[model samples]
Target: MTPPITYDGRHLLADLYGCPLLGDAALIERALRDAADRAGATIIGLHLHHFGEGHGVTGVALLAESHMSIHTWPEHGYAAIDIFLCGARHDPDAALQSLSDHLAPTRIVRHLIRRGEAP
Candidate 1:
């Protein structure tokens, strides 16, 4: 049997297109940290990985509420991002906007998921 899913929080999934220079892990990390702060979320830790020169980056910011993560494809000019927070006290949409502003993507598709819901 599959495990049940939770709906006690909000999760924002985003696909960013037409992004320029997606290989900078440090910049993405900073942007996420700033976004978390703007959303009034307490950040616990952050982890980031760079694929290689002119390749891509993957990053995750562990927050007191939950976590936010991002992966990029410089060659394709695309990025996938997830901003999941465990309560309404923080705005995941606002955090997502902050990241969009920092990255300046030409197109963005975002979806919000309710987590920890009763079965």
Candidate 2:
């Protein structure tokens, strides 16, 4: 079997632990935008939704290369971020760093998966 050529890309799973400002949807949006910018990714559109005050926030940035998503739990002081960008033009690690800088998580854990890899 062979993998499709179009499947090539980088996917980053970022876990922000002991983070703050998870309830701030506006900040999260800004962070996402900054992350995309830092990664040199083009944003076609973006959307953010806040569950409620003192609750969680969900945000997604639609990029030309792919997408970046964030789900926050303010009560738990945690945020889960996923950044998947296609092609080699974008740096998903920079996006993750941007998110960490904006949110200032006490601890961060991340994994990068290379897409389109043959089994």
TM-scores of all predicted structures: 0.90, 0.93
**Model 2 agreement with the true structure over 55-101: per-residue lDDT tens digits:** 99999999999999999999999999999998787899999999999
Model 1 is weakest, by summed lDDT over 10 consecutive residues, at 1-10
Model 1 RMSD vs true structure: 3.4
Instruction: Flag regions of model 2 displaced more than 4 Å.
Output: 1-7
lDDT of each: 0.89, 0.93
Model 2, residue 67: what's the lDDT?
A: 98
Off by over 4 Å in 1: 1-7
* TM-score of candidate 1 on Cα atoms, chains taken together: 0.90
**How many angstroms is residue 45 displaced in model 2 relative to the true structure, after the best TM-score fit?**
1.2
Q: For residues 31-64, what per-residue lDDT tens digits would candidate 1 score against the true structure? A: 8899999888989999999999989999999999
Cα deviation at 24, candidate 1, in Å, is 1.2
